[model samples]
Target: MAFVGMDPERIRKVAEQLRQSSHQLTMVNETVQRLINQATQAWEGQDTLDFSDAWTGQHKLTLQQCSEQLEQMSTDAIEQIAQQEKTSGITPGGPGSALKPGDVIPGTTIPMDGLTPDKLNAMSPEDREKTLEAMTPAQRAAYLASLTPEQAAGLLNGMSPEQSAGVLAMMTPAARVAALSAMPTEDRRKALEEMPEAMRDEVYGAMDREVLAQTIGHDVTLAKTESTLSVEAEAVGFKIEAMGQGEMVVNADGSSTVKLHGEFGGGRTFGSDEKGASVTAGLEAEREYQFASPEDAEKFIADLKHAATSVSIDNPNPIDDVWKVLDSGHHVDRFGGYLQAEGHAELGEFGEIAGGGRIDVLATPSEDKLEASLKLHYDASANAGDFAKFSSGGEVEVKGELEHGQLSKIELKASTNGAFGAELEGKSSSGALLTTTHEVVQGSNIGQGGEVKMTLSADNPGFSQVKEALQNGDVGKATELAYKYSDVSYRQTVNTVLADDEHSVKLGAFGVDVAKAGYHFESKAEVSTLIMEKPAGSTHYYDISGGSR
Candidate 1:
């Protein structure tokens, strides 16, 4: 009898295959049981006892359970075929009629032939499992192919641990990766939890490298730094504070990224201690290392672990390459490879001084050297306060070269023109108030002779010594050598346009101060320093040796 909306012949074939599989499983289980029983008679130690327990507790049990389920499934499939044949002889639309196109099975909305993945997915877990169990392999594959990756993951989540393992085992590598990658981390963890150790190991080993990294997630906050700059002079004061927060994350493909966010704000006050006018400005910047290579990731993780450990005097292990991980590479991505920064200053009676700058960096490797270029542009202005008022704009270009993964040379060119000024107030020896102000009016040019350039070649004698010390984990020796032959210099010429007895006093400073005075004040300085420390509790001394001009 011909069946409607059904393939009775295919169903019979699949049932026969399942019956054969069940029989094969039964034979394998019997053989394993017999071999284990025979082995136990001759061996009677802990090792043999462990082997016996494993076979009986997990392997044998799993085999028996699977055999029973397959046998039951084959019987059900055969009965369905028989019922279809019996109903085929009845009249169409009668109680005993075969299921027609679009007709659902009793107590379910699942159609016999036109079943969609959406309908299958909508069924309860038990119903879905039963329906899939009854389908031929070709029918099952067709439906599975139509499911989205997330839907496939959902099916895995709904299955028991053994069933989930079986499903994953049956999928191709690509499909398996997609399904597991789509699953939530916790859900995937749960799926791996209840499986036997061997099966769990197989599942883990089969995962793609990138997928495994994502499944075992790692995001760590590496460091945080804050700084405050405070300048105090008679009748004038200002304070600037900055904080930077950074995080490092290992990417799926073994790359690493360090994200940084920094914020700064400050205010300047002038006049008497009780009453004064104030101007304030705030700014924020963001930076990222888009793709530091895998080696750098390992280096950072190693250094972090080293820093957190305590060492004994007799077994000291110093960390090398502490601040040198991501410096040598072309690490920035194309789209967002620029530093983004912006800020505004509120000038008391005047309007506001507002502007920002963008800095773009590009690096490329050629032969044995890596070269990097940087471009910067900034503009800020206000039509008021002498200290705040300004109409200024400028651009800077810098290039650096590295040899053997170490910095060897640098060059800079900058052009700037604008009206900018500064104000200074003080008290005279006889208690007289004194004031000095310098301003470059609109259209005037600064940084016109302000080009400052520096270079350090690997030919320097101390360079190799420093490298060797670091490689040997002698951080103290490395620091000493780095500073001994360091090529650093500074030059300053401050010609007071209008100086008096009161303004002659020094400007107590925090950072280095360089002055070249004229209509415009130009400052140029290049500096590098390294400090070494002795063992703890012993007298600490700095082995500093460098010349400055």
Candidate 2:
């Protein structure tokens, strides 16, 4: 008769052989890797490169795949033997006792639906796992999805680490993050410790940036002990307020000289006092975050890519928040800081411009405060096509604060002045110039009685007008047509709190008004708390009104 099932003993023997072969493959791979590592130190030339590439890009991968295949085969064989035993009733007095090396069992099948939480809980740990392993991924996922949170918590609490991992492996990434997030803090940490490194990284990547920030407070080991000092200064002896791009220098020897430059895009400038000359080179700027390890850096980058921010500020989230998200439920023994500066300058047709920016980031673990600041400045003058001369100068300053990895405050100051002049067809001559300044301060709290405010004003001809001006070579005409489209806004907020001995109350008032083109918007808010002395508690009240044009 044809064999319907292999002998369990024979299957076990074959599995042992597969396992041995896999072990041998691993040994060979290790030896080969050692040889490659040694050769890498002394190797040179195309032949060496070719050998290394073949070994790493093809041969090494092939060997690893083979080894994994062997191991999987061995595991499958053992599992198959167990399943057959269970199906055939292999005990001495059971139905399959009389069967030989080649035998067949009639109508043997395990019902997937027979596995329930009750059955799972009643079975021995080994049998429970075996039943779980028998289920397909779809079956496992469906079964898991059907369980209530309480049920899931109970089930997971009862499972061994391996079983728990297997259950989690069946979940989608989002579901997995949710599951972990729902777990009790200590249990979650223990579970993470029990998980495989690859699985841990996957969990980290899937977590919310803000949530991850709190979790990451544990694992990191270093913090910044000090900050670097930075200084910058600039001076102008004679500057034409409206020229936007011209600068005249009166030397100490009673001689004066004027320099004009114009350029487009981004660049940097270098000068030599001895040579009395300078050069401007076009370049692009780059930003980077420094981390203690490559793995941490990778996680930080991944979280940043997936993170979302509210429309409250122009600068990025504080560095501490980024660090916390990257940390992901790890203790940070100490904090560290990162400082970077980059500058560039380019010479345009009419004027010379140089600009650069700086970033300072520090995390104070002791005070639970994080600070970050940035500064940028630029000046340039260039011919706008054939008909216009364009010149502009601007500077930006921003400071951000985070308390315990949460944004608590921010401030921004910026100013710009520029002029656009055009002589269309060398006959229709027109020119326009504008200057702007903006300041904003936003915070969760401005101390006990602190105030917050912002002032903004701008006279932009709008982009469409600017484009038409550039195309028609009549900037002055464009301003005349669209300069009426202007914007001005002001906001002030005051917060005051009163507290003594046994009772406390707070009062707040905020107002803002904005006007642009012919439209206007205004809003106001006021709040007060009822005063209560010693025995009674204080009560607060508030009212707000939105203004209409």
Candidate 3:
């Protein structure tokens, strides 16, 4: 079974994406505030309020107050998100690239989600042995803690799963117990579940069964934490009740199998893994939460494929290569000059875009151009009523070529559902720009009207620095650079929304409309991720409006 679950890497990816969305929204909000302030100022300076000066000032004050509230709220929300990121152990600015396996510091929260067998195996053969000899679990944990989290993550990611486990197994039993005990319940259990049976048994025996039973689920179809015992905590949830008694079966592999059978109503078997174990229900209400089964090692490859964000992420190497590269504990954005990427989408017309986020691309060199497939998510749903959500709503796919970083040729096709919903044949080709200005002259009402000729550094950031940081997995670097290097041209649409206008409609303080046109522009810059050189199309918008009365 493959683990297409919320692993750490995936979590970081999703969070980073959301953060970007938040920032984009903030920019839109600021634009609106600017427009409101401008409109009030224009009325006071250019148009006659028709009402008393106090009336005009009141309206201006109201607008100003409203702007402040919104600005404060936005600021607070952004800060809160930052705090959450820190709490979640998300490395600032990048995919948790800084987190290392060795970061399992003694006193800090231990992170074991990234540890996999492949990572251990990839380490220098002697490295695991060296670590085992060099440090006890507490010592190792402490040593890792001494280094940066990234360094720890790096050390762990570089080793093979066995190597990593071996290191952990070497922890002085007391240190192991302390570290495991200190871990949050879910993480401790999950980490133990991922370890080799011997190592797992060591820690598992010490875990609080109540906590383990509470947090762990019974569905092992996805093989989340390899050993099926993780499911024991949820046998009932899986609809399997304990039989008269559990049986211990001796396997030819010298592994011990704890056979637990209860009534589960399904008819067919859940199928076997690369290992011969199978879970049967209905015709046989019995399932094996077997420990004697041969440990599955290549399972992670299946996981990588299952966890694939886009079809393009598949590399041009042996299946093992995926784990090997991931095991290297280094950024692997591009493999052999090819990169795989994904984005979010919207599901159910007017429904929450909760699960609709989907866009995938694989960029590869084609002669002097790039070859890629751009897939866009159109709809999605869960098992609410009749059918599963995604089964019905597929995607719009564009197979295209780009010349000199610009889209050149393309072929597009949409799923029948997508085509039907959009009223198109579900096929199309597309190619897809941004400016700003400020001026104050004559129409000035007072010599005090300050010319805020403040130049906004309009220089378009090449995005090279941020993009480079992104590729290197230095999210913190990437984010810092993104701010240091920004794209201002995109917001010019805000001008299309509204700008410094003279003599616009004014709402008199007396609630009477003064003669004049009110100026306001609802400008919006679409925020979206580009895949296959085609923008998924951003529904995010920003607008500004203001006019003097």
Task: Give the distance in Å from residue 446's predicted Cα in candidate 2 to where it truly belongs.
Answer: 40
Q: Which is the better candidate, 2 or 3, if ranked by lDDT?
A: 2
Question: Best by TM-score, which number?
Answer: 2
* TM values, all candidates: 0.24, 0.30, 0.16
Once model 2 is optimally superposed onto the true structure by TM-score, how far is the C-alpha of residue 390 displaced, in angstroms?
19
Task: Provide backbone clash counts, one per model.
Answer: 0, 32, 39
In lDDT terms, which candidate is top? 1
Per-residue lDDT tens digits for candidate 1, residues 404-458, read 7888765454645454444343333222133233223222222211222223346
TM-score of 2: 0.30
| Per-model C-alpha RMSD | 27.9, 26.3, 31.7
Give the worst 10-residue stretch by lDDT in candidate 2.
532-541
Where model 1 places Cα greater than 4 Å from the true spot, the runs are 1-109, 124-151, 154-178, 182-190, 217-247, 251-549
Cα error of candidate 2 at position 312, Å: 22
Give the lDDT of residue 95 in candidate 3.
Answer: 46
Ordered from best to worst TM-score, the candidate numbers read 2, 1, 3
